[model samples]
Target: MDKCAILPIADLYIRVSTEEQADKGFSQRYQEEVLRRHCEVNSIQVGSVIYEDFSAKTFNRPQWTKLFKSYKVNKGNRPQVLLFTKWDRFSRNTAEAYATIRSLEALGIQPVATEQPLDITVPENQMTLAFYLTIPEVENARRSLNIKQGLRRAKKEGRCTGLAPVGYINRTTETGVKYIAPIEPCASIMKTAFEQIASKTHNITQAYIHATDNGFNKSKNCFWRAIRNPLYCGKVPIHATPHECEQYVQGTHEPIVSEILFFNVQSIINKKREQLPKRSNIEYLFPLRGFLTCKKCGEVLTGSGSQGRNKKYYYYHCHSNCKSHLRTDKLHHLFVEQLKSFKLSENYYPICLKILKRTLTEEAALKTKTTYHLTKKIDELNNKIKKARDLLLQGDIDGSDYKKIKAGSEVQINILCEKLSALQNKQRQLSKDVNTGLSLFSKLRQLYEEGDIHTKRELTRLIFPEYLVSDGKCFHASPVTGAVKRLYNKEHSFTGLFSYNLSIKKELLTQSDSLIIEQENYETLGLSQQNNVSTSEVNEVMSLINTLAKIITIQLLK
Candidate 1:
């Protein structure tokens, strides 16, 4: 019996990249039609059609892998040919395409391009295939090079090239130029966060909370990145290349903050990272730990409780073999007496209060001027938004363009509103603020003795300025703010802060010509003494302490 002869069959492979479809008019359907017509004209049997929307840079495509798997599984039913519209449609890489073609031939299948067909049986035809494959590969590389160059040029021009950062949205101009613009509430919120961090008013956690309350919902990591991004400061960071190092360029977009503010925030963040977090349960019992050092080893003293027959006694230890230790209560008494020595006499009280109020009045007036300008800016932004809305209604601008404008304007308005509101609050409390500012000068000793551990520690930092060294009997600050020593009178009754020989229970802080902790050393912002107390409130109280301390400096300097 004579067996029936099998007919030649080909599976059509159609691929259309997005760039090719838009630029070169390549379509999967068009390629399929041409391939089918070629098979029809050649009298070859039509098999399956394999479609791929992926790139042809390699043959590791899902459809290509699936087709190869089926050929191995259904060898008897598999087509004898793999057909595509052109060589580039099969693969852009010459090496991979040649390897794939050889593999197909080994599987009793011939890979063919309909538009540029060549017989594999002819040895010279391989050269033609290489030429066809090489041209497209070179074109692909050229396209990639052009794209990279275009993006680099755009970045150098201060145009945002990719997705916008938080608080911004990507938009295009009427002439089709793409850019990023700030959006609503998020932009304002981010600005507030930046200011707070820069001014050291709020720690990162507090700033993140402020952002969250103001409508930001991203993760902490995202917030951190947003704060660090120089885009907020209107600087575009160009990526590093072989020829050039990475650098920042001035951006055309409106900045959320000034460059100085942004860099200040970065510095604060870096310092926070370098400084270790302090978590001690005995803060209330031993508030002087970080402020005290050993006279012998010069190491910061640590505190611990010792059990005795009568009661548990707390002592500051040198944490070394020198065994320098002091009773915590006695040291506390010495610190309180030092603070009391700064108190003004009944005659100087009126002069000090008058000076503090005058300084505060000048500050409040400057703040009022700032508030007025902020108000003016807000009104301008509101009017801009109104004009944009009118343009939208009159068909002068499309909805997307109007939306971008409105969003940007609203962000500016929100930020100004926050600034204005804060200013108004400060102005409202001007009289109270003056009194608050004098608290450190008049009532610091009382406050330290009665206030929480946080208050005591802050007092220690402000008065000592640096480490206070003691050997159980005598102690003195390394240095104090010179303003405290400069407090003088015509009567010569009270000469200086250290001139008073203070003694409490026979432990005296010896008069020294030195000062206390530097303002930069105030790194205990995160230190919390008690449970259920808000960190923000602690920050507020600490801020008040600093303001008072500053007032003292200004008053004495005058």
Candidate 2:
């Protein structure tokens, strides 16, 4: 029709790299349709189509070269435009990219994108183009780095990182991620999975697939990673590599299973990995494996099994050159008997209470006596210095003598000032000690008498700080200032382990004779002796108790 009419396009080109052409978003068919619509609107003629479906790493692209040649020789109305999906689809390298743009401009065609047009242009325009592209890239990189750092920190704190392992469920808490210990509902599934794989009913791959199909779509690599991951074990893996394994970093989260069960699973996996697997002949139960130690050498006394012709039995054997081995059951029984003697309820309370009071009172008395002496000395020095100054300033002495006396008085004043400051600090600390001592002892006693299993465990750990079994006898080192040491034999040189085994002799009761009652005890015992006691006063008293307790019990008690 018209000579200046929109020129028909020669060819429609489309390209997408593997990295780009995912999720049908950058498919060639989709791009072709969009480009064709662009062509139809512009009245561009179609000569030939060129497409690239691989990487843009090099200029040796076949489809691109074909498009260049077609534009060069075609003597008819030259194709006015070379259309692509986007700028990155053209080329990633800047040099090759510019060359292509220049070459296209030299021919009667313009290199254009279905999305952004100005991006495939001069250096200045490309720089602006890079600025736009960099936003998403930088964000992606920052997110990746953050995730990596979070994983490292979580691992050091003993948290389970990444997806929950096959045998475990992710336990979400305010304290961060922990793996749920295998119990009831989930344990059956986990046990079955392990048993099936171990017995070769299904290989690991099949097991993984089956688990995934049955709503455990964490992936095969995830399953394998879980199998190798030591987070399931209570003893956290220091590092993925054996060389770095020695540097153990404690994790903060709760363990999914016990150390023994975790080790057993790991052993099974290790056997499968090795070409020539040597199966462990015996199963040993090391009850005091983590606790007991050799006095001569600080090495732990590990438990081992003895295989006889008829039966197999377990024993605790010292790894050091000392002959220390005993039947496992006997040693466990001995531990129970020793623990029995400790009497955590009555004996522990009276002993801990006595130690607590005596130590606190001693600390307070020390503080008070020191402060009193320092104050007395300060008063004496101040009086002496005042008299000296009066004598000098009253013209009763020569200028030189006055100066000498004033200098000497200043020295005494400085010493007194320092002593006064020390006394004040001691006074403050004594006040704090009184409050802390009362609270700590009271809580310990309550925890001993009415505490749950966990609380009792904490109390036991606090009192029985050390315990050892040597030559079929148990020994414990109770705190020197503790009730156990006070009521027991004072000359007995604090037997570190065997002391816990000693009976709570009746004499220990005498130590709690002069118990110093506290101001806070009135409200703590909940003895609202007077109904007229104001609610505000009661609330204030309760508020001082414990923040955690106050949050829950505030309304109920009020």
Say which candidate scores most in lDDT. 1
lDDT of 2: 0.53
Residues 481-517, model 1: lDDT tens digits: 4333323223432322122222431122122222223
Count clashing residue pairs per candidate: 12, 17
lDDT of 2 by residue, 1-558 (tens): 775465655466777777677747678888888878877776676656778876665567777776577667875746767777676666665556667777778876777766776744566887766653454445546866797767766667766565655555567667764654444443445554554454443456655654543455466676777656656544454443322222334445445544434444555667756542232222113435645666566567777767778555677778877777767767656655554433223222333434344554555466578777867776776777677778878978755665555555554454456555654665555434433443343344443333322333343443454545455554444342243332232442122211232244334433444555446533333345464545554443233233212211211111
Residue 477 accuracy (lDDT) in model 2:
41
Off by over 4 Å in 1: 1-5, 195-210, 219-221, 265-547, 550-558
- Candidate 1 positional error at 41, Å: 1.0
What's the lDDT for all of these models?
A: 0.71, 0.53
